[model samples]
Target: MDFFNDHKKLFSSALAFFLCLTLVICILPALDNQRVIQPLPNAKHLTAQETRGKLIYIREGCVACHTQQVRNIDMDQVFGSRPSLSADYALNKRMSFLQNTATLMGSERTGPDLTNIGARQPSKEWQFTHLYNPRAVVPASIMPSFKWMFIEKEQLGPNDIEVSVPDEFKKGVKGKIVASQDAKDLVAYLLSLKQVELPSNIPVREFLYKSEKKEAANSGKGGNLPDGAALYTANCVACHQASGEGLPGAFPPLKGSSVVLGDDLELYITIIMKGYNARVPEYGVMPPVGTTANFKPEEVAAIMNHERTSWGNNAKEVTAEEVKAIMDKIK
Candidate 1:
């Protein structure tokens, strides 16, 4: 009773109690988790440029709209190869003594999930153009342009990188849109957001409540052929676009491409599997989409067929057998 009457003693007792609770409930568990969990075996640490870009990303408040998480739901399948695991965040270190590392698992998804954006859209040119003016690449995009990341230069130096801005989105006052160092760093960071492959021993969690429509498509019930349009939308639409007309001066247009319409099936397959750099000065290097995604012969045929048929470019349809034969020869 005397101790309670002493306000300082009572306050000190209460403070000690709360501190004990915090240690038991918060700090202890966090330390235990850190000890038990480890980063994926193949996970790479951020490079100096990527780290700078990450800081810029934080400064730009990108975490406000985009999320770095992929929930274990069928809908989230588009964002990553598999559901995100606790180990995915185990490598995150504190920014400083005062600042905790941001997982960037944002509540609101005002934009698409960026868990695997690096793999989905790897082209630096596309990234630069998109950042300078979102509408330049995606006409229907609601995302605000971060044109401040770039500068208009009358003449570019030997090492300077330029963004290809279309006339419609230029909004007047034009010179070459040169990427600042920060912009390059930011793109580098964004391009490093690839999801690593889980080890073979680890059991993967399946996406829950998958739709019957998707199940039916995956089952190959109809003629045993995969959906070309779906494959294109998932793999190619980001750069080539739904209309098949790629962004001018960034991604090459597939609408009337001679390779797409040409009789040279082998060349087309090679480009898809091995990738193309012949038009580097005019266009960004096309990544080896087939190789990276481990695309099957059927999958490649589906994509090729989709490109050849879509956007009013009629050409001979390819079979999985033809694609497989070419892929084997190329390898």
Candidate 2:
């Protein structure tokens, strides 16, 4: 009481000094902890093109709707193979020192996570179409168009790299959609956003616990028969939908489709392994979803079976061996 009354300024100064000390003690250790992190084994520095693309990504405010992170908890595992670690952003931190900004690890997730987008959706054609008009490719998407990044050219010179845009998305433009250098750079950056494989000790958590449990329960009948329905739900449900009815004019419906019920299993396998470019004018081209998703032969077989069985379409179940044989023959 005496100190407060007689030495008010001195007391205030001491309080301020302690508060600052506390902050330093708390913050300094955290900063030091970040500095000690090492990049993952597969993590690499961005190429010049990718760096320029990263700049474009920032300039376009992509970080506002999309996140480049996969968290350890919650629903993040659906976006990536594993939970993200400090090492994942080590390169970003190093670059930030020279660039005067930390990282664009976004806060919102209105769009899907980009941490593993390269591995999940590597199709350049798909990326270009999505950028031109998100709704054209994904009918229900709320993402705004980035058509300005592309320009319509009546003819392509020998030196020009052609960009494939579906006619429906072209908006009556009477020429090929040529991606500007900025668009090319942005795609390059997006393609560079693959998640690095972490060490065995820090393994990716199994997000498909239900599938694993089902497999375990059915192990007695067969050696872990892949849950086709579960696999389809995890992977194919997004594009084809839960009802197996794809978005009209955007994605082809898998329900009661000749392809899903087709006797030519090899064709289906090939389509899954290699992507389908606009085979039909009315629908958007299907990207190499299986390839990007890293679906194993067994998993692919399971997915095929699920698609055939569900939506009132009955077809013979495909085997892992059959899928493998088809994959090997094609490759």
Shift of residue 130 alpha carbon in model 1, Å: 0.9
Pick out the ten consecutive residues of candidate 1 with the lowest summed lDDT: 214-223
Q: Which ten-residue region of model 2 has the weakest summed lDDT?
A: 214-223
**Which candidate number would show the highest lDDT if scored against the true structure?**
1
The regions of model 1 sitting more than 4 angstroms off are 214-223, 280-282
For residues 3-32, could you state the per-residue lDDT of candidate 1 as single tens digits? 989999999999999999999999999989
Model 1 lDDT, full chain set? 0.85
- TM-score of every model? 0.93, 0.74
